[model samples]
Target: MLIVITSEEFVEDEINIIKRLLKEGLTTLHVRKPFFSSEEMKRWLFNFHAEEHQQMMLHQHHFLAEDFQLKGIHLKEEHRKSIKGKEQDFLEKIKSQGWVLSTSFHELQEVENQTLFDYAFLSPVFTSISKHNYEGKKFSVQQNKRPVIALGGIKTENIEKAYQLGYQGVAVLGCVWHQENVITSFKNIKKEYKRVYQ
Candidate 1:
């Protein structure tokens, strides 16, 4: 799957771009607005069509996931660390509710050890395009047991390389949101991914 994550801070016309992305076949959209209050997040979510709501994964106010009928809930790396012991019960409840579970990882070992999540993100596979001085480590997914989506600095040019490295999917943030034409950038990345994977 080709996933697109929202920037931490909302960008201009982000909703429009996201709608267009869903219209253009973007299957997953991770809503990662850490600074947005639950009420603020609700108002922002209301901007989308009800049908579009299912395509999103919330990074905060997970209670909203069920309310919005969102696809899933995402745990930021820090959030995951904070709830170390309660993860099992949390995962069971979320899974029982049919919400897809996902989280982030900076290390390959963490990805391998976590099999309960439907998928997870392993980032910085390439030099980051949106975050300054955040270098890429090119983490390999060869040993991962669950689906591992490569994140950070993913672009059309290196998509094939990500596939070759054994990533089950790729999550694009900077490569799409930072562009002047988000839809066009998304299409290019999707095209490149299909060319390489299909």
Candidate 2:
């Protein structure tokens, strides 16, 4: 199972926790700090000294990715639409730089329409602190072969349910961020996910 850690929810000790998770085998680390400025993010990346084990992805800032040499960039559905006509241009730029691109979708139709990204995130698969009223009743992966990550409200207990429902992996925030022991929480979640997926 792959774990994608968001930077927004885990502000304090973010770098430390991320480093720990990367060492423990996190598949991807998405630096999704929408509130922070590009300069601030660059500063954080420089100061944090993120290791090579965790592939880093910036959110909605393709320019910064180019400047900082990040592995990839993630765009929201709205952002994706705004760049619709320029999809090829954007894809070419990302490809030229050898960067992976991903986007988030709220519906299956959107997922079906999106072909430019390497993966797509379908969120709120289960009720989560980051989101509410997500009972997994409306979430479905459909027939899309592209990797789709089930985000929002995913925990150690419900990860198996997510994978069973056809998600390539699960993205999380509060589940690990809110824990007093981030390392233990990540390790346990990773262990549980491996057991279920294996």
Q: List the residue pairs that clash in candidate 1.
A: none
**Please, what are the lDDT tens digits per residue for candidate 2 over residues 111-185?**
766678898888667777555565555377857778888888888889888877888888877788877887898
lDDT tens digits by residue: candidate 1, 52-110: 99899999999999888999999887778787899789778997888998988887777
How much RMSD separates candidate 2 from the native structure?
A: 2.0
What do the candidate models score in CA lDDT, each in turn?
0.88, 0.76
Candidate 2 off by > 4 Å: 7-10, 132-138
Question: Which numbered prediction scores highest in TM-score against the true structure?
Answer: 1
- Give the TM-score of each candidate: 0.95, 0.90
